[model samples]
Target chain A: MSDAMVLDGARAEGLATVREVPAPGLIALKGDLGAPALADAVRAVTGCAVPGLRRIEAAGAARAGWMAPDELLLVAPREAVPGALSTLEARLAAAHHLAADVSDMRAVFRLEGQGAREVLAKLAPVDLAPGAFEPGELRRTRLAQVPAAFWMEQGGFTLVCFRSVARYAFDLLAGAAAPGGEVGHFA
Target chain B: MLLLTCPHCGIDADETELSPGGEAHLTRHGPGATDEDVEAYLFLRDNPRGVHLERWRHANGCGKWFVAARCTVTLEVFGTYPAQTARPPQHVLDAIEAKRPGATRKLPVMEGAR
Candidate 1:
């Protein structure tokens, strides 16, 4: 199967990809088990071996880790996309813990440049100032009541939503993009 | 601006997730526990400082009932444990064990506990 799926609509075209690296902007790993083990699994997958911060400790320069107890999302380059999930689940399995693959549950996207933040403001309640969210900060919220994951960096903004809500959020976001600004996609 | 640690959902949920049962500890003066105990259970509170454990529903996501640890002072949350679990945290266990009449630990007793 193709590594990525493209979803086209009236206003926006969503590039749905099976990311290996958890996407540069936001990555989430959801589990049905306990938080600590799920968080540990995230650490194992992201290749950042740290200690003490259990279940959901922020890791990496961009602050990728478990945002919710049931899931962990990592923020990394688009190129790291393919192997990210397996590496995470495998490490957790070795520890005698179970980690469910939910990468498909969410759709990843990159919204950057000067116009991206303006587009996000229309949809999110939190301010998206570069200084405000920085790189590592992660937030769980609803984009039109659809569960979403978000992170900010110098490039602009990256967000992920459950596949079920991807199309809806994409239109909302794409519609909100600046008058002349373009929405770009990379998997 | 209070942060509630939901044991079941495993996140620092917004105050919206809780309905503010008002206070924590309660009196149980019935056949062994009374109406004054019942009245006090029905209404009244101490509103103590430090670590407070209270009942909260995961209204948005899980819809499961759970206990939460809340700090009255800083409004910061530590963590949460499942409500029906065989063993709750030692502190919560201690609070229920140390019940004294008219002690006034907190308010909004669990309706189901009656």
Candidate 2:
């Protein structure tokens, strides 16, 4: 019931401030690219357009992030997920598509500070140069042996990973953020 | 440290983010297949030291399967393409041919209908 379920008892004045946040209502949509039916279903449920490639699009109170060429992650208020899933499923029934609720299967984290990008750079192999990787871009890569996806929020980066690996993810983030471990890649 | 580009996601993915799916362009031998046919299909892979076409999935990034042509010896990736293709595209083949001339391993032609 606590937001720190995954990142419990973690404290340090590190490069970035890492904390576990409540997971958002997540619906994973998988279908053919450029499929109108699937797009309509997603837009109808999230009030947001399906993001292009690895971009994240925020609209109203909901948003969608591109997970893959054929997959999109819809983020919305947790309370609206059940009804949203039903609507999405009903609309996508005629198409060769898959729409499933992944809210409970995942965990969320936030990393703030100038070291945020550096925090992820240490864990992932992808380029985290502030210039190459700007806000609004979503990246899915291996985070210290676990798969994670991160996108920029207002203040910092918001990360999502499997709930089972939430504790490990938090530790990885915290360890990367530990003081004196800075690489200053973003500078 | 091998950076492989995922044709689907258009990102050069790290080898750690990928799962090797073994040899690429395999013709499956289903029911009524001989023991050799099954063995060749499943176990028998073209282990060429030079140009090798292999299957790789961007497991951590895009999660889409793709085919990669790289040298097993040099570890130089010739190119990568979407996994849906029945065989390596012309560009990938040309790249392999350009590097290791005549090193491309052509799938052995079966005598009859598989």
Candidate 3:
């Protein structure tokens, strides 16, 4: 994340705040994981149980989002990734799986404030109404033209897109968040 | 806008999020096959007017290929299943037949699948 970031202190002042945030560690677990054994390994690593489809589970600072049927994106601090990978590797040795460290491959941003929901609604196609997209739900969909995923976090959302398109994504978000008429659809 | 569920990820995906793969349930025309078989495999396709089985990839979402049973004229998608199936599942066929009688009548290209 430190190597290729174009937005280090980027932030937008509006009813919604779109600011670049330091990346927590990101790990991708993809495979045919058998129950109990693999589930235990995941819980042991992230402090959160394997989430159901399109859900994000959190325990303390660690989070695990179900990215696909066979994939879970785990989040930990930067220092904890190596240890987590080793633990997962040892437990899943006989199991067919891939545990990869992808902390640096992403550009993460936090969209918060009174206008946060409208900012997201402008960019993403998902329904962001209160009951429709509440806290703890994870959605992997496109942000404008780029592939992105965002999850509800209390009053706001934390979004992630590929590092290669961070600038473009930031521009899109900031532009939508610029001082303007309020959609208030989610408000 | 055609909406299809990704059978693998269990998400309702918009057509913009999906890449349409023309037809589904095609058998290969690999080695040891005659010219007619190869020609049919390479060129022939079922352009049925209704109750069609087609392939779709969830490009922006789960990134998995899925088969969709749909009505070509009405664009009413009956069901979606995984792409790993060599032929449309019985339930999907039944769903199609339920809406359009004799809808499972196979094309020449699909007969070998059964």
Candidate 4:
């Protein structure tokens, strides 16, 4: 058998730029948000404070965002993930929390350029308005019928959906981004 | 689509993010309880036409279970509260009373109950 591929080697086609961010480290941290030790362990690992509700905190190469009151998503460079998870686990061993590497379980896509937000708006039910979802904010919601997460980054958006339906997400984004799609207009 | 605010996350969760959990504050009737009591707990529901209390889960958001006081007819949401309490919070009751005067339905208080 051939080596497994991402997005099944499919490419995004549209006005908005859509491409997979290959192999980013995704670690899910879950615990009681009120625990100071959990916060400290997260800070020690990520070099940034654990973000508050619906917020993202980035320090140098590490980025951590709140997924829920008791859950957080930590992202780092692909190469740094293993060491970072080990350090985090060792530090947070005494605390009541769970840390798991979920890099391979999710597919990350970068949707950028002028029509990126519009493309997302077509699928997601949440408000994509600038004021509602500003930079560094994260939303765990449905993209069409699939569960996904969205966050604003680098003047664009980063979308993460389960790897099982990644091709479907890519197809939806590409179709929405195609020219003459009539998005953001009342028909 | 009903927009319910999650008391835990404070987000106005759209109906898609929320899952409706039937009636709220049901008295459990388990072993040693009378068959009538068990039947009431299992099958009986107020199904009131107006003011009602409901259980809802912020399934797609914070994943916390909460109680919502809403109008069955108009779909007007009075408020949401945490699910840990045995009864509706005072403020939630007050809001319902204020909105629909004399319309609040009280749960039957058992004699010698805590």
Candidate that would win on lDDT? 3
Residue A134 alpha-carbon offset, candidate 1, angstroms: 1.2
Q: Write the per-residue lDDT of candidate 4 for residues A100-150, one digit (tens) a residue.
A: 888888888889887787788888778787677788888887877788888
A best-first ranking of the candidates according to their DockQ comes to: 2, 3, 4, 1
RMSD of each: 9.7, 2.6, 2.0, 2.9
* Model 1 TM-score relative to the real fold: 0.51
Report the Cα lDDT for residue A18, model 4. Answer: 80
DockQ of every candidate = 0.12, 0.86, 0.69, 0.60
DockQ (0 to 1) for model 1: 0.12
Q: Model 4 Cα displacement at A87 (Å)? A: 2.2
On a 0 to 100 scale, what is the lDDT of residue A119 in model 2? 89
What does candidate 2's lDDT look like per residue over B28-51, in tens digits? 999999999998898877677667
Model 4 pairs whose backbones collide: none
Q: Which residue pairs overlap in candidate 3's backbone?
A: none
Model 1: per-residue Cα lDDT at residue A42? 55
In the range A22-55, model 2's lDDT, one tens digit per residue, is 7878989888758888778878888777789899
As a whole number from 0 to 100, the lDDT of residue B91 in candidate 3 is 88
What lDDT does model 4 reach? 0.81
Clashing pairs in 2: none
Pick the winner on lDDT between candidates 1 and 4. 4
- Native A-B contact fraction in model 2: 0.93
TM-score of each: 0.51, 0.93, 0.93, 0.89
Model 4, position A163, has a per-residue lDDT of: 85
